[model samples]
Target: MGIIDINKVTYEYIRRDEDGNVEGITTAVNGVSLNVKAGEFIAILGHNGSGKSTLAKHINALLVPEEGSVIVDGMDTADEDKTLSIRQTAGMVFQNPDNQIIGQIVEEDVGFGPENMGVPTKEIWERVEESLRTVGMYEYRKKSPNKLSGGQKQRVSIASVIAMHPKCIVFDEPTAMLDPKGRREVIRAARALNDVENITIILITHYMEEAIYADRIFVMEEGSVVMQGTPETVFSQVDMLKSYRLDVPEVTELAWELKKAGVPIKFPILTREELKEELIRLGKR
Candidate 1:
């Protein structure tokens, strides 16, 4: 089995009336099934209200599926007995670093997770060092989180999750609130975790540029996965992605427009470097 599996899963949020009667239901996830292999970087893309966040909560067992099942590392998340194990196997990071950080000191915040799990003091410090290093926050171990920049604080939050030694990490819009530099820092850290540490990463983001690094990209709309493929394959369908209310990477869009304008440019140019190379080659013709 994969590190994470969703089998025919569906979730609904029931709206209650003042009298506690069942008023209505909104389906957040509808029969979504996906498998994430060990040590792979996966990205989920969707606009607001597309159930990407709902699916992320399922990975961490924050919400149980109304129908079907979710399994993390072969343990069913719906099983009460495996709840803690599931959480330990898949740590979650939210969009806001302030919400995730608690300890007054940076090292203290990073060490909190392992300490809570009964790790020995010495081992906790070791983990704190390793985790902070993993996220490039080791130098700030003694600094206060309040004094750090938004990107630095987010890295600390990620280090906190890493200290728990989870096999998979679910990052739900971890860069949404940051500036360009902060966003790049968070994304680079996320990629490093997957490439160097071989950790399974599930990144949920609306930014098309962020999805370029993923091994596979899944596009969601109205609680269903409408598209799934490598970044190149998915971004090639510019019109289809536009129909789903999602944007492609800027360079890819430019290439698509060039093709439409009879420039004879091919599809799926993801970066400016790639586009420049292609244009140079075309000019030689």
Candidate 2:
């Protein structure tokens, strides 16, 4: 079985009136099924309110399924006994670093997860050091999170999650509030975690560029997965994605335009370098 599995999972949000009466229901996740193998880097993409965040919350057990099931590390999220274990197995990082960071000092902040899990004080420090180093934030261990740049603070937030030694990490638009450089830094850290640590990564992002590096991509719309494939395969369906109010990476769009103009450029050109090479080859012809 994959490290994370969603089997026909569905979740609904209940709207309540001020009088505490049940008003309405909105199905946020609709029968979404996916399997994420250990060490895989998966990207979830969609427009705002596409149910990506709701799906992510299921992986971390923040919200249990209203129907069907979500399993993390072979444990069902709906099992109350497994909730803590499920959360530990799949750590979560959110968009706002300011909200995640709790300690005055960077190292302390990183140590909080393991500390809460009843790890020995000495071992908590060890995890804090290792996690910070993993995210390239070890040198800033003594610094205050408030003093760091958005990128740096986000890295610290990632370090805090890593300190829990999770088998998988769910990032819910972690780079949303970051500048371009900050976004790059956070993405780099995520890549490093997947590559060097072999941690399964579930990244929910709106940025098409960020999805390029994923092993697989799942595009959601109206609480269901509308597309699922490798970056090349998914981005190749330009019209479909556009219909869903999503965009392709700039290079992919350029390639699509070139193809439409009868240049014979392939669909889903992911990077500038690849586009340059393709253009060079076409010029040689």
Candidate 3:
């Protein structure tokens, strides 16, 4: 079994009235099943209300499944005794860094998770040091979070999560609030975490560009995984992705458009260099 295993999980959102009446119900996750091995990079893409976030919640036991189970490293999230362990094994980083960062300083913020976990004072600082360093934020450890940019703050937020020493990290649109440069910084940090620390990463994002680096991409729609494959394979189906209310990366889209316009190129060009190479090949032809 993988480090994270979700088996036929279903979750619903219940609406209620002021008088505690049954108003309505929305099924956010519908029989979703998938697995993630240790130290793998996975991306989940979906439009708003697609239930990707809801599924992410299950990884750390934020929400137990209504009809199925989420198991992390052999521990069932539904088991109350395993809740803390599940969270420690699969830490989450949210979209907005502002809401997540609460410390007066960067290092202080990063230490919160370990401190709460009852780690030794000496080791808490050690974890804070390593986590910030892993995210390339060690130099700014003593700086006030308010003085940092969006991307820097997000990195700190990520450091906070990693300080917990989670086996896996789930990022819920972690770059949604940043500018282009900030987005790049945050994404690069995430890649570093996977490459350097060998931590399992589950990124829930709408930005297709971010998904390009993932080992595999899973597209969600109506609370289920509609497509799952390598980035190249999934982005190759541009029209199908569009039908799901999502998009391919920019380079992929351009190549797709060129193909549609009668250019003798392949589908799902993932990078600028690949598109360039293909055009050069066509020119030579």
The C-alpha lDDT values of all candidates are 0.95, 0.94, 0.94
Tens digit of per-residue lDDT, candidate 2, span 87-184: 89999999999999999999989988898999999999899999999999999999999999999999999999999999999999999999999999
Model 1, residue 143: what's the lDDT?
Answer: 98
Q: For candidate 3, lDDT tens digit of each residue in 1-285?
A: 999999999999999999999899999999999999998999999989999999999999999999999999999998999999999999999999999999999999998899999999999999999999988899999999999999999999999999999989999999999999999999999998899889999999999989999999999999999999999899988989999989898988898888889997977789889889999999999
Which candidate number has the best lDDT? 1
Error of 1 at 72 (Å): 0.4
Candidate 1 lDDT, 39-135, residue by residue in tens: 9999999989999999999998999999999999999988999998899899999999999999999999998889889999999999999999999
The 10-residue segment with the lowest total lDDT in model 3: 263-272
Q: What TM-score do all the candidates reach, one by one?
A: 0.98, 0.98, 0.98
For every model in order, what is the number of clashing pairs?
0, 0, 0
Please report how far candidate 1 places residue 27 from its true position, in Å: 0.4
